[model samples]
Target: MSNYTPTKFATALLLSVLLAACGGNDAPAPETPAAEAAGTAVEPTTAEPALDAVEGEPALADAPGGDPAPADPGAPAAAMPADAAGLVAGRDYEEIPGGKPLEPLNGKIEVVEVFNYVCPACAAFQPLVNSWKARLPADVRFTYVPAAFGPRWDPYVRAYYAAEAMGIAERTHDAVFNALHIERTLKGERGEDSPAEIGAFYAKHGVDAKQFASTMASFAVDSKYNRAKQFIVRSQANSTPTMIVNGKYRIKGTSFENMLENTSAMIARVRAQGSAAE
Candidate 1:
């Protein structure tokens, strides 16, 4: 057994190769079509569907933690409620009078985006809305308020905050979308690139590994979500991509640009009325 001829060595190598090939063949095929389809992550749609807020338009089929915001795609919001003062038609959404109430920015115009990472619609709105965000007047301070709606939403939201906590938002925010929508990677799906998977993605992009893990579980991140929740509950946002101009009006639109336009108008409208801070 210790001494072998060149031909014997060659024979042994061939046998080993054959055994490896057999092992490869023995592995089972992937999950079946139906099973895979159900498990497969949904690729984000290229174009957004026409959103009708009042006509009972179906809510997003998926919610992160709770029910989708109540939007009736059929019946438009009731004409801003008769008693609503200082609000405008198709302009300001909420109705709390007084020249643009103060915001978390310490009296600056507060524009908050209540968004979820898993929502295709929110992903679609980002590029267009981001442009307006970039152009927001100096007096304005915009904030991103990621929602924690359900189990599905947490991973994405956590990934976002985790990256931010690790100070890698600039690097990972867009990459996350590209990962999920463009590359068709199911980083969101459990077991693959789950939260830990996303965290790894961040680490690859230069995020501090320890920082990423701690940020994911940090109370500070939880506080951020809590603040977002309270903002919606108090403002009665009731919809994704909602904007509150100076806390007096809610602005929403079919597309991000339109929402931005309406938001700008609401801001000016409130500003013209005059600032009312205590």
Candidate 2:
């Protein structure tokens, strides 16, 4: 019998509530057609839709070995689908002022997804992100930036950089999520897991447990983790699963599917602009 209990469920629910609170508030419903027919004058209101999380940058270290390398600037851009056209700014997405990527573009369109392992929403979004990432064109580079929203979340941020530095991040990414949310082997926000425990979890993946724990607190990991936090601050992102495209556009959508569609379109747009500049 599984030992999973409401504590995990409650933790996720609480974090979700926090995510909703920090991100944009739910937009007020527009006047319904029935209300209009009733001759009630409804004032127009403008508000941004709620994002997944919002809490709110620098050249990040090179991605772990598993990520696809950035595409050549001269490489052809992917075809822009019809659905990508006419996306409303501030409605479908928001433009970041003086935005920049976490890493030097070096001619590739960059996409950074801000996430935290403790974020229930991010865990839910991972499978979708993976599928979308697999289809990306050669000119696009996707990176994951973990957020340490609080003390409880900070260790995982350290762990992520440590794992990345060790080149085990790619293989261990999903497993970490599963361990916390599915397998219940690792406590997330409910009860903190020590560095040694986390390292032990990665041991199953073939890394030296003690070395992994040491790396979690190493200077390299510290630098990378801080850089990620800086980039998140620069991007003005406060939520999990937030996607920034080329550091120019912050993707927003009514739903996850919409977010992905907007991201694909934005990638195409950036690629087209780059092609034009040449």
Candidate 3:
């Protein structure tokens, strides 16, 4: 909700992200790590784009009344499974973003995006993110792991989590991405993206000042960040916007076009046998 978007990995978290992985199926219930694990540790989804529309920009929009939105022009994102009921049957695997040990992805198509605010790649992927998001069916669950690849990425995460806490994400989520990615402003001269400064940005977006402050400093937000850390470690990814389908499959941007198609196909294939055990 804050004007600044947080990076996937913070500088201090790099070593922690590369730490030990929880090996056993500690929690269990079917497909995704959460359902199969004796319980579930489902993470957050791709952020809602902050909604600042120009006269002519392709958008990531949801069905206002229940209509499927337009598909991205670049390429098909992760596709639905061949058999709608077979989504859970895809091959099971876990990936670590940047291949640095992060957390353990149990099953399911675990799509974790490791983003840094300053990264051009993340920005380039922003416009198309909405289109890709709309197509996901029930069989798949997605998560966003804010990464502070370095000092530059830290503030963005702080702002991201803060907005989540304040419940202003719906209003300011896409705005922050657009501001940083599309606009390409934000020189970050004097740590202007700091929590306090970012809070101001959220206020400008229409979030109340008191709520924004509370959300930024809340224990819940910190806990959310902690969970994200676990996801980062399990995926072993080293960059932003990386997709780990079913933990076992790794998909990058070049492959992303096909990645979505294959993932959807895989999900449908798996889900057909039986429903995901929740």
Every candidate's lDDT: 0.52, 0.70, 0.47
What is candidate 3's lDDT per residue for 192-235, written digit by digit as tens? 45566566667787777667766766787777665555444445
What ranges in model 2 sit over 4 Å off? 1-84, 275-278
Q: How many backbone clashes does candidate 2 have?
A: 9
Candidate order (TM-score): 2, 1, 3
TM-score of 1: 0.61
lDDT, candidate 1, 200-275, per-residue tens: 6667688766667668778987766555555545555544445676655667544455556667777776556566
Ranking by lDDT: 2, 1, 3
Alpha-carbon runs more than 4 Å astray in model 3 = 1-110, 188-192, 210-214, 246-248, 253-255, 272-275
Highest TM-score, which number?
Answer: 2
The CA lDDT at 255 in model 3 is 34
Q: Would you give me the overall lDDT of model 3?
A: 0.47
| Candidate 2 residue lDDT tens string, 1-278 | 23333345434533543443454534311112222212123211111123223244323233378868888999886653343365678766788877778888887889899888876566656766877899998888899998877666789999999999999899888778767756668877657789999999999998999999999999999999878877776777766678998777899876566788888888887776673122
Error of 2 at 225 (Å): 0.8
TM-score of each candidate structure, all chains considered together: 0.61, 0.70, 0.55
Model 1 poorest 10 in a row by lDDT: 28-37
In candidate 2, the residue pairs with backbone N, CA or C atoms under 3 Å apart (3 or more residues apart, or in different chains) clash, namely: 53-238, 53-239, 54-238, 54-239, 55-238, 56-237, 56-238, 57-230, 57-231
